[model samples]
Target: MSEPAMSEVVANLNLVRERIAEAAVRSGRAPDAVRLVLVTKTVEPSRILEAVRAGQADLGENKVQEGGRKADALAGEPVRWSMIGHLQSNKVKDVLRFADEVQSLDRRSLATALDKRLQSVGRGLDVLVQVNTSGEASKFGLTPEDVPAFLKDLAAFETLRPKGFMTLATFTPDETEVRRCFRLLRDIRDRARQDAPQGDTLTDLSMGMSGDYQWAIEEGATVVRVGQAVFGPRPLPDSHYWPGAAGTA
Candidate 1:
């Protein structure tokens, strides 16, 4: 597929930003309260560079290898890489090579692996715990009931900082259901904060995407991972990346 023209990409980005601003205002939050992480899963490097030139520095990727490649290629740029997809323990090292943050941390084992890897580099990483608020069997995240214990366990990993929580809402046209998922995530974040360690700063709620980011912001999202709205639609089907996303797109 041909790459989108830079002008077109910029225009789309402005539109998305406008929506974000509107959402923030509606929620009585400052426009800067939410951060936009452009998801570049299957997008070409050249197009991503265009976005960088256009002033989008935060980029998100679903796969470690793919994100690693982009990070290497754009090494000198002022971009910050974020891992916003389910991560495997074996890929922790690769992810650390470029990712400034990981927004999909779920289980204790993954945290253990990440902490070990960070220890090797003498560095630390910001992470958001992924929660399966929608209750989708195919989704990878800690169940709502399991998040408190997971958050407590994460305190042991000094190298991994808990930044808050991340979640994927149910993929459906029904606005009520989608908002419910976002609300649940926000509630989880609120509850987790009570028992979180004094040093563990849980502040970010990474929710929403191309389809429902505005609703997410309204429901208290501090970070929104957007793709199609800014970069144009991916050539592949959404189901290829997310099981129930095809119909929503």
Candidate 2:
């Protein structure tokens, strides 16, 4: 497929931002409270730089290695980077170099690995727990039943801060069902905050994507991960990052 004209892409971004603001208002939350994390998966760095120049503060990259490469390329750029897909334990160290926040801390093992890496670097990692609200067989996340133990175990890692929660909306595309899942993540966030240790911080609810972010915002998503809406559909990468020869979305 041919690349979209930059002007068209920029116009689409404005429309998405307007929709996000509208959702925030409808949810009785301040529009300023929500942050947009443009997903730059298969998008080239130049297009990402354009979004940054246009006032986008955060960028999400699915692969740690690719994200690191982009971070190195834009070393002086002022965009905050976020890791918003399944994180491999092996890539923990690589991710540490560029990710200001990781929003897919779904398993206890990954959290432990992250803590060890952060401790080695003498810096804490900001993170959000991913919940399997949709119960999808292909998804990776902690089930609701396991949240308590996960949170309790997470407290031991002072090098990682629990910022919020994240999840992929189901593929069925039911708006109400998607909102329900987002709401569940919000509730989990609240529960975690209430049960957290005295010094623990839980402030964000990241449970949206390009398709249903407005529903997420209406249901209380402080952060939204959008790909196609902002950069247009990503082109397939030259190589894949995982076993299926496919990269995370």
Candidate 3:
């Protein structure tokens, strides 16, 4: 596939920002309340740099290796990297090298690994717990019912700061179903805030993506991981990463 022209990239980014502002206003929130994390899973580094030069600063990737490479290539550029996919314990060190934040933190073991590695370097990293609100088998996140206990356990990891929660809503055309997933995540965050010791600091809700970010922002998403909306559609199918996305897309 041909790379998107810089103009096209800039245009798409502006449009996504407009939509984000509109959604924030509709929800009675400030436009700056929502942060856009551009997902560059399969996008080339050169094209991603085009986006960086165009004013995008936060870039998210699903795989540790791929994101590490991009971070290395753009070492001097002012961009923040986020790991937005399920992470394996073995890759924590590599991920820490570039990932400013990990949005897919779902279990205690992963947290343990991250904390150990961050302690080795005497550094701290931000993280958002991933919740599988849709209850999808293929999705990787803590069950909504398990989040409170998870958050309580997370308080032990001093180096892994709990920034907020992240989730992937159901891939569906039904607005009601999609909204239900987002609402579940928000409700979970609210309840956790009241119950968990560290919940007060869990302010960021990393939800939404290219297809449903507007609805996500309306439901209280503080950070939206958008890809195709700003970079154009990926050459590979969405189902390769998200099951059930083919029909929805």
Candidate 4:
């Protein structure tokens, strides 16, 4: 499987957490405010269990089938699975079965599908409305201007609890552009919160990946989706992480 040893995973996790703490303090916020959702897109269940036992309980997978399989394999483990990929309507039931949160609630069709299924089950799911803050054709999310109204629309879905926003910054090495994208999502969140309903719903900013997470934390990201640094590198390209880029992938 080529994954790291359990001890290596623990050391990697500690390094990541230490960096997170440093970033949070540098940004004038407590490290506890930021939660890390370790991305395990292709990571094996046994390796994932190693991390869970090491005290990193929240895990994120970029595909429904993969996450469901891991959830089955890691059954009875103290892990919380988050559906962090572009979820189609047909996969709603499976995701609801395996995921504790949906981080890519970017479109109304998906929301309608989720709301319908959750209503049938009489259950609720915490969701983060995704924003394509980078304006890339290869990402899935509402536009910056469209997010406030979308957050307002979420109120209609009684079973879908809107917790905050998630986004993919531009896949570039340009620090300025990358940080700009993070800053924009923060601005959108702030503006959305001016409305009482959205204000109550918007509390988290789930932006940044392994490379850009520190900048995201500096700009008020409450949840950072990290993978490569904690689990070694993956074969996928940075663009592959965007839900909208799956067709070409």
User: Please, what's the RMSD in Å of model 3?
Assistant: 3.5
Query: Can you rank all candidates by TM-score, best first?
Result: 3, 1, 4, 2
Query: Against the true structure, what is every candidate's RMSD?
Result: 3.5, 4.2, 3.5, 3.7
**What is the C-alpha lDDT profile of model 3 across 1-249, one tens digit per residue?**
999665887889889999999999999999878999999888888889888998899999888888999999999999999988778999998999899999989899999999999999999999999998888877788998898888879888889888889988888878899889999989988888888888589788888888899999999999999988877777778767544333212
- Runs in model 2 deviating more than 4 A are 1-6, 198-200, 237-249
Per-residue lDDT over 1-249 for candidate 2, one digit per residue giving the tens place of the 0 to 100 score: 999666765777788899999999999988777988988877778887778777887899878988999998888999899998788999998999999999989888898899888888899878888888887666778898888788888888899888777887665566777777888888877787778662246778887777788888888889988877877655554134322222223
lDDT preference between candidates 1 and 2, better one: 1
**Candidate 2, residue 207: lDDT:** 71
| Per-residue accuracy of model 1 over 1-249 as CA lDDT, tens digit each | 999655877888888888999999999999878999999988888888878888898999888998999898888999999998778899998999999999989888899999998999999998988999989887788899998777778778899888899998888879999999999988888876777672337888998888999999999999999988877778888667654333222
lDDT of 4 by residue, 1-249 (tens): 798655877788899899999999999998777999998877888877778988998999888888899999999988898998888899999999989899999888899999999999999999999898888776788988887677777888899888889988887788899899999989888877787385756888998788899989999999998887888877776456544543111
In lDDT terms, how accurate is model 3?
Answer: 0.86
lDDT of all predictions: 0.86, 0.80, 0.86, 0.85
Residue 209, model 1: lDDT of 88
The TM-score obtained by model 3 is 0.94
For model 3, state the Cα shift of residue 114 in Å.
0.6
Ranking the candidates on lDDT from highest down gives: 3, 1, 4, 2
What candidate 1 gets wrong by more than 4 Å, as runs, is 1-6, 198-200, 242-249
How many residue pairs clash (N, CA or C atoms closer than 3 angstroms) in each of the candidate models, in the order given? 0, 0, 0, 0
